[model samples]
Target: MMRRRTTLLASCTALALALGATACGGGGPVTAGGGDKALSGQTVTVAGVWSGSEQKNFQKVLEAFSEKTGAKTQFVSTGDNVSTVVGSKIEGGNAPDVVMVPQVGVLKQFAEKGWLKPLSKTTRQSVDANYANVWKTYGSVDGTLYGLYFKAAHKSTVWYSPDALAQAGVKPPTTYDQMLKAGHTVSDSGLAAFSVAGQDGWTLTDWFENIYLSQAGPEKYDALAAHRLKWTDVSVVRALTTLGKLFKDGQLIAGGQKEALNTDFPGSVEKVFGPEPEAGMVYEGDFVAGVAKDQFGRTIGQDANFFPFPAVDGGEAPVVSGGDAAVVLKDGKNQKAATRLLEYLATPEAAAVWAEAGGFLSPNKNLDLASYGDDVTRATAKSLVDAGDSVRFDMSDQAPAAFGGTKGAGEWKLLQDFLRDPSDPKATAAGLEAAAAKAYRG
Candidate 1:
């Protein structure tokens, strides 16, 4: 079976299905001439929320594209709140040719405002043939394709320390009941079994989504995304109930709920390899292993390993991982070149460069695993693409802005509260449903 791994920041993909590398030389603008007419004097200004490693990789791709098309590409990296910056640019009529934002909900809004351009026939055919269902499903606003997918980072898989589990004589669980059994085994040894920075509010939603994946399956989730399913549905309630049980079972650290609300992405992994009380398992993506290695000097395969979030007994396995994608603005000045970049990004060379640089899973299925930097990342990428089973995008990321905002955070708080006492699962879920319904109305 293909081994699984998680991507960085569960919210990263939720924030867009979210992209490259190279050196550069001064060049003139190019045209879209294919054969002998090669694109020679075109320039595409890319506005993206990429900096540091993301920028480094992106430059490589831009340089490569420049080399191929003789097009001069300029990049402007935005701060984390790219939405605000992008909004102002759109209003000021200074928007770049291309911008990468997380969450399709924002893309839909842009499409509604006529900020994004419709795809050309070529771009449409390319995306249809190569991109996965997740993006195609979310990339469209109405029936038109407003976004093109490039790279993805997975979120739903659980990260753990296999060596640590073996040392504690605990096996990885295959079902919810089995997970509880393993948790008891590890807790008996006085070590943390599950570690999460629950203070982030989004973290709780990750847990909630996992439960939903196991209980309601992908059909219900798809309906949820389309706003057809009620949050108070019995299946949704069951998922919430399940999450509450896991929280109260003493499987996680004592202050997990509190810690989740306050801690950042790497905190949970640190607990697993930190100073005083090292934990054995932390549910996170492959990037968390990098954090553990950087902060605690732990190697991934040596000190930690990951597994799929187990099958739900007789139910089908839920494909869970989170990643980001690229989108071009329709009415923007550089719409043509932006669309070209989107198509270029789906190539194997670009995909490999992205995977090697940032350890991100590129959405391009044509990428060769042999080109990956390491076996772990290669394996992770393979698992993400090969997932033929049901796969749902991240919950908060898939939901509307209202559901992903304070209201959603409040719902998670309620889940935590209900986990502290499961007697009111029905009431808690109903309340959440009411909140979601109210949010949808606005």
Candidate 2:
């Protein structure tokens, strides 16, 4: 699923001041193509899943591009089903010039259909200079570079209120069992241990992914992602059962199961950081920090902090990451302008534009740590890069969209069902396998 967030104007204004730019606008223009207005008459259209405040921040990046190259840029939100929307546009010959694809599976699908343009040599060079080889590998199809991963997420971090944890007299956990114990302790102090975002099925998939990756290891994770191993495999059952250890406890969840099932992602975060918090912690990506700071006026490192998603059964914690890749369309009218946008996105300057805005992370090794608005975000990005080859992409995003990305269906819906009644891991596994078999066959 595509994560969507709405940031406050105050947050945007603060970021602008920090970067010496206008609110939700770019900094001073830097000339591109050896001229200030080289692409003066051109317009470029870009599409992605971002909307509201997220879209506004991305517009800042585009604004910087416009100032440099003198190209007008438009951003179209692809809504939730990005693949379907972009596919329809392509069929109707109204495809955008550029797309920020969130799913690697979708990127591969577009490449296979010959709808995507191979990135320019200049863009590839920028990627090589700024990113790690693993990022490039994900952007490539059949050994040809096709996308640049501009926005990255560290999905293994768990955000919590330090005061709440301290009230419970517990420290951040280092293992799965310890985390559960901490939850129980926090619950005893009258706050729900976790604000489960059951309404958003993607969050549940992330929970399962972290546990599965750490407990079963990367080989099984890769096999399941490719459907080489069935979802009914024992490894999946073990992971589901492990997750049930936490979800099975009603008191451990904020607002209980019913309310949690109705709560969206942002609501889940609010339960922990709001004026009168209902929960002590939330599990998701590093973006939670952005929501906490932007929406609740919480200080990231002090008021809100995170620990590595604790290791499972004494194993090393696995980093399950996700990113949005910028890909140009072959059918685009302004090919040169689109390629230049891709090149700009690959630069540290572009990454820094969003980094200072909060709730954003980049895989660009060249980006300065100071560019992040807070120490937590900088540490999160550092861990993501420090993990190097050990990091695994989000497993669901690696699967076909029908099975992984769709709402109210496939892995997403099945996980929601499991959240409602976590008693039957075997049954959930069976259902997932059935769905995967169908999606893979298609």
Candidate 3:
């Protein structure tokens, strides 16, 4: 996870996925050989929204790639609005050689516009050897692979403090009803039942997606992602109402919707596990473990731990995943170097580097799980792989950006409104449906 973890990324075969420590050297303009990866000295420009420590770690990985290929890699921080910055760059004919795209919807949009270059044959084979078919489908648009998923996150985990739960005499819930029961118990114990990242609208969307996917099933999830299912549908209403139970009296949550709305992602976790804990649990991806460890200086798997999001409606267990995808742009001045970078990223070695760094997970099945830094990290990675065919990608990510990734104009805004006052699930569903209609139209 890039800390922000607004994430998804991915490819290569025959060439070893294992790598040694990155070597040091200088890179500049040099002639390319006719052989594959003919990149000797070429500057490949890569852009992403990652910053702070997350960006620094990724830079280490890029530096490692540079060591092996003699290609100078420049990393650009795209801020929070990667779409706006990258779009402007593309329009101005300055698209970076390789860009880390966060959502599958946007990647497909890029592919449709012919702005992306397909992965080379070796890169394609590498992807095939490393990731599952579902992951392969994520990078493919119209039967052509346009992106590689590099960093994946398990969204179904619920982080909690055992001491707090024990104080409330509550065990981790295994079902939605059981969760609400536990919530009531915690509230009775005068502690928060949940800490939400309402300020960042994306987190609210994730809340809806997880419950919707776990309860309503994948077919419905796909329908919603494709915009074929209206948000006002019965299943949608049911999902919202179920979540509403936790938000109802403001007694179960650390901060009411108002406070939650003002709290950022990391702040959301801080409310739960901070020195003076205000909440007993937080529902987020595995990245929260990294945030807890890094920002708040807490010991994960001890002070904080996670469990699978409980089931709802007796449906299948939930395993929602999202990550950053790397795409080679057609406008990339150094396509060969960019392709080589993708080859390196697809290997287990690259995933291992980031996984050991914390707050990150890779879907690379071939990577040895032992490389993970801790038991919690290994558990998160293993959870995703064990999900197999039952896994579902982030629903909003698969939708049009206007409906998925937009901060204030689409699902994000609608979900925030729903969080503020979840009294009317039907109204919330209608609002979401109305927004989806407008977003899908153009």
Candidate 4:
């Protein structure tokens, strides 16, 4: 979907509001309580939307940093709506030393407001050596670097239940046309063809983006993300028209448009793997495997399989993705400690911790492929790297937060409407262009 789990931040003022208020957080430098390392009394606080098992797994990486640097670290799970929660923290003069921004849009927005801390010289050198220029590009705003993409997800994948596909007597579609044919065949076999999470407009947006990228190529995709190309452009029209082929047909979707609109991401996945499976396939990132495994207790490669989202324009498989970047604040409570954390994350060793945990991917090109959790993840990682420059970040996350991140607003609203009834591509285009224009005007 969008940046399924992402980050956000706000601006900060130099003045500390009171007579003698230090920058960012309330505490002084917090080093090891037992006084173990060279630096004493320094604890760096990290805030993000990560929690539960993801939080528990990430703790291992944090502990690794603590062991290596003797700098105590506390991770604050911000829960859902990171922008709202983290923005409040910053405004309240308690911004964490380092904040994770999930998408380039929020990272750039935070940097644009001068809230992020620039990477230290030592940390910079480590990231430079470990990551590719493309991954690095997402972390930098203009010419200054502020974030590091630590975790990544490959969005250009379609998950299918092999038994369902076989019963339908159709293989996964190799081409866009073949995809539609497979859908029809699956329907003919008395199964819904697609399980779309229409409740989350971003998933629908992703569908359009994948089709557009394959059909229009990367240049147009980038232009659109930068608003260099208007939503009213023929490229967008073509993509929407192509989307219409499936979305317009109610029988093709599980429970039709109404049910699709009500089905959330997890529910959409459940449609394929649940007891009374509703659909044969769902298009999502590799993370969905974790969803299947954890929620339904299904064996991924056995019960479910995936292929790169089939090419729509007779082009290569479209691979769109989302990733999390670690952006340190310039006025962080403990710059040294935060820098140490970033340095650890930049290394291949830390990546391997989460890698083996499954459902995690790193854009660090230096990391070995074997570090991935499973054969499926390895293949997905390879496809991601192989896509190379062909890869594009999720489009909505690149748009204004009001339009992209906010629920019941802008693209999310209009696209929900479009999916409800997609015959009128021109109207949908006009609505999209209008909302985008208003949001971008800010």
Total residue pair clashes for candidate 3: 17
lDDT of 2 by residue, 1-442 (tens): 0110121233233323223333242232222223255678899999999997789999998988887678899999999898999999988999899999999889989999999999887677666656678898889999999999999999999999999999999999999999999999999998999999999999999999999999999888888988999999999999999998788897799977788899999999999998989999999999998889889999989999999999998678989999999999998888888987887787666788888777799997766678888888989999998898788899899888989989999999999999889999999999999999999888
Off by over 4 Å in 1: 1-43, 50-52, 70-82, 274-277, 293-297, 405-423
Better of 2 and 4 by TM-score: 2
Error of 1 at 434 (Å): 2.6
Model 2 lowest lDDT segment of ten: 1-10
Query: How does model 1 score by TM-score?
Result: 0.83
lDDT of 3 by residue, 120-174 (tens): 7766776776678898898999999888899888999999988889999989889
Most lDDT-accurate candidate: 2
lDDT of 4 by residue, 1-442 (tens): 1221110000001111110122322121112122135334679899887776678778877775666556678999976466677778888878788887776777878888888877766556656666657776777888888888888889989999999999988887778889888888898898899999999887888898889999998899999988888999998999999998888886689999889899999999999988889999998888888888877988878898897898887776788988888988765777767866776576555676777777687876555677775788888888887766567898888887776777788888888998899888888888888888888887
Give the per-residue lDDT of model 1 (tens digit) for 357-440. Answer: 644676555455666666676777777777733457777666555565342344555655565465777898787777677766
lDDT (0 to 1) per candidate: 0.64, 0.86, 0.81, 0.77
**Higher-TM-score candidate among 1 and 4?**
4
How does model 2 score by TM-score?
0.92
Q: Candidate 1: count the clashes.
A: 36
